[model samples]
Target: MAAPSPTDHKNRKLLGRLSLPESRFIADALRAETVGGVLLLVAAIAALLWANIPAISDSYASVRSFHIGPASLGLDLSLQHWAADGLLAVFFFVAGIELKRELVAGDLRDPRAAALPVIAALCGMAAPALVYALVNVAGDGSMDGWAVPTATDIAFALAVLAVIGTSLPSALRAFLLTLAVVDDLFAILIIAVFFTSEIDFLALGGALVGLALFWFLLRRGVRGWYIYVPLALAVWGLMYNSGVHATIAGVAMGLMLRCTRREGERTSPGEHIEHLVRPVSAGLAVPLFALFSAGVSLSDEAIAQVFTRPETLGVVLGLVVGKAVGIFGGTWLAARFTKAELNEDLAWPDVLAVATLAGIGFTVSLLIGELAFAGDATLADEVKAAVLFGSLIAAVIACVLLKLRDRRYRALTEAEERDEDRDGIPDIYEEGNPEYHLRMAKIYEDRAAEHRRRAQKAAAAALQSAAGSTTEADRPA
Candidate 1:
């Protein structure tokens, strides 16, 4: 055989670069998010079961009443309620962080790249609301739940994707995730505005002042949360009292950090401060929020009530059916409008499957349901039922559709790639062609890494579709 051609050498190098080393950090992160999600699910189910057991009712009451908080705040909350209120705020902050990342560098970065997901997300939101409202238009006030099924749970969705493995084209998975992230941005906006109560002008003013100061500090090149952290707390308190949700503050807090120079002459004080607080938000705040908010007293008695409860039914149906129509239909319409383009790497079947998967709105759905009906105990109960009910349905739908879609799509895509490179120096992987393997490995590794980061950021945001009072900030006026 003639000496390996230059093209062959090129292919080997590329493949080598593409191969992924199993970094402990990545593996740990995957476990952190995956296990964390699973734990929340289990804890929630356990709570629901335990609360209903006659012997555990009193114990459940005790559990709910148990308080948790940092001593410094001179505060401790009723365990159950605190989970909904206090710990959730940190969850919101993390949501904001993830949202910021998406807008800056991830799925939402390029308008063209973002089109399919954006459209799908919008469709997901509108279709669910319309369908829910149409189903419950009796002026019975069940309309409050129009927002219920519109959210997607990012972590849970990704977990589903993991199970499906190489069956689904990576591109489709990414597109669906990006769509979910954008949908979450809208959901956050809706909660801050529509679901909120009356506002306190003074508190609103303080939030504005905080915003102004934050902008000024950014302009002045201040990156430290020194002045900002306290302001965030004050904003949260004010917003909480202002009739606006508090968690909006988390994003407001992050907005300042987003302004930090991507590439500075040196370092950023404020950005560093924000970074230090991030783990607090992620590790402590979010977990606590999950434990607290995920609880539902799923007694048989409650089960009977859910069928008659609009909020409960609305949430359940919306998540299951609404999400499917909205996400799938919207993506189809958008792609058709945009030159029939999906992700360059994905096909329509793949898109639909991923959209189905996007319907699994667990974490975010739970969080928002709590916020949307916070003060009303009866309503909160109904909302809880809806959340659990809707999320359960959505998860099932996602798992089934994704399983089927990926299987067909992956095989088709692989065959097409093969046809594209049937000649000598064939596709990225040909046994006996070391160069090709190296090149293929590099492409897969680089693209996959970048793609994953964006998807994860979007995913992190998507998980907060249910992010309600778990943060502090003035909702936009």
Candidate 2:
């Protein structure tokens, strides 16, 4: 075999080390998602207990089935539908904003940096659907649920990482985030394309007009929650009535938002909106959706059906086996064929662990399962059980692998900290010498000087305005 060139070596590495800002951002995002994941888990558990405990199970069903909203506009839907169709739109909206930010400004802006994750995400999704389809075909079952195992729930995956991979490289988290973001985009496309039953052209046209108005107002710098809220509600309603999944409206609006900040602005409009709405989505919307959607009856028969039913069985195997193989194999193939290589800090084992973690497809998987078997309530419940069981198995396996990796990394870090050179300084602190500190100090000093100049300029302008006002008053007297 020929030796790889330096440029090839540089370009080929997967999960390369992240920049400080990017690392910090990932950490913050992981923390937030960890909380959301916990909430989702709690809600799912509560729902299961409520639905299976004979005394309260009927009430749970009744609450989930109760209808609400206006009937005149075809807006009346059961509480479960509201959680699935309405609140999930908020979750997808946040997802769309993150996707936009990443594509426009984050690591995804560079095609080279994006290629690996993009390929992995594509393969990750494809493999699951393929697995599901093959299983269903062999068993003579329906193919509608092929997409059920295709999604990777970011909240659950990140939460698992946060808990088990503290000493692992930040690059792993970045890779997972990028992969999940691309996964979300593909999932949205799938829902919008395959799930629609019919199109109400007029209503769809009205929705498009509303979206255009939204873009126009945002571009024109029109600001006010009152105006945009009503407009957004109208757009969502029109979209729902158009025979399209209403969540598409949220994704559309999120993509349209400006992701870059203007001069003097601390954050972009998309960032600000995500910050404001993320809490609502995480704390309320998603948990409520889980509460309503995850209330599957876990009877002994239901449990057996999850394994025996071809469609449901496909969901289980797809998530537990297919996701791991697809992601790991895709990344390896990309590196083997292309100039890219595995990141020096990460090993094939780490990638495998992360890939396994990706199999916890909780939220979107459930949504697709419901959509796939909408008419067969029994089948849908069985599918839900399968998803829960599969995700649990995947989570446990990932947790074990990640914990092992974390221990190794922790030991490596400790070893690095203990080793010292002849100069009596630890090798780990060599890069943090006085020279590096001096350079950082210089940078801070220059920023401080620039801030002082701006402050003086503003003060001078204020003083000049006050003098002009005094002169005008004196002259008038």
Model 1 score (lDDT) = 0.60
State every prediction's TM-score relative to the real structure: 0.71, 0.85
Cα lDDT, all candidates? 0.60, 0.85
Q: Name model 1 segments beyond 4 Å from true.
A: 1-35, 65-77, 138-141, 160-168, 223-228, 259-282, 342-347, 405-477
Compose the digit string of candidate 1's lDDT tens values, residues 124-161.
88887876786677435556667767887766665554
Q: For model 2, how does the per-residue alpha-carbon lDDT over 124-222 read when each residue is reduced to its tens digit? A: 999989999999999999999999999999888766666664555566777888899999999999999999999999999999999999999999999
Report per-prediction Cα RMSD to one decimal. Answer: 19.5, 15.7
Give Cα distance to truth, residue 78, candidate 1, Å: 3.5
Worst 10 residues of 2 by lDDT: 1-10
Return the lDDT, model 1, position 163. Answer: 52
